[model samples]
Target: MAANENKEYSHKFDECPTCDGDLQYQNEADAECLNCGEVFYHEIRANRHLLWDYDELGWMRGVVSRA
Candidate 1:
């Protein structure tokens, strides 16, 4: 994975997208919801800036081309 791509843009999720609550990020690949306890995973593809691709649990929400 191109780790540098992530450094190009610094991002912090303000609230949990699933429950609209607080979020505690374990790392770059993990996001845990403080309210619902839902864990979401994301990937930083090669040469792509997709901040998030799904809502939760495989829900096809958005391909979001950029951060």
Candidate 2:
């Protein structure tokens, strides 16, 4: 994958706090408001860089199947 491309898909939500519009989740915990351009952090950690990078953490999710 390229520097910009990520193996895992980051979640996105639309919800604006200032304008009560839409907020998009930039990463696991950070969200940005589409209308007001506000940023919200759900889970605050001491080391932010370490938490967001999945490759650094070596997190792997198993596949799911529907019967």
Scored by TM-score, the top model is 1
Tens digit of lDDT per residue, candidate 2, span 8-41? 3233334443466776776665666677665655
| lDDT minimum window of 10 residues, candidate 1 | 47-56
Off by over 4 Å in 1: 1-9, 46-66
Which 10-residue window in model 2 sums to the lowest lDDT? 47-56
Q: Rate residue 35 of model 1 by lDDT.
A: 93
The collision pairs in model 2 are 13-23, 13-25, 14-22, 14-23, 15-22, 15-23, 16-22
Please provide the root mean square deviation of candidate 2 (C-alpha atoms, Å).
12.6
**Cα lDDT listed for each candidate:** 0.60, 0.42
lDDT by residue (1-67, candidate 1, tens digit) is: 4786567435656476656888677887666778988665555556443545455467746643344
Q: In model 2, what is the error at residue 20, expressed in angstroms?
A: 0.6
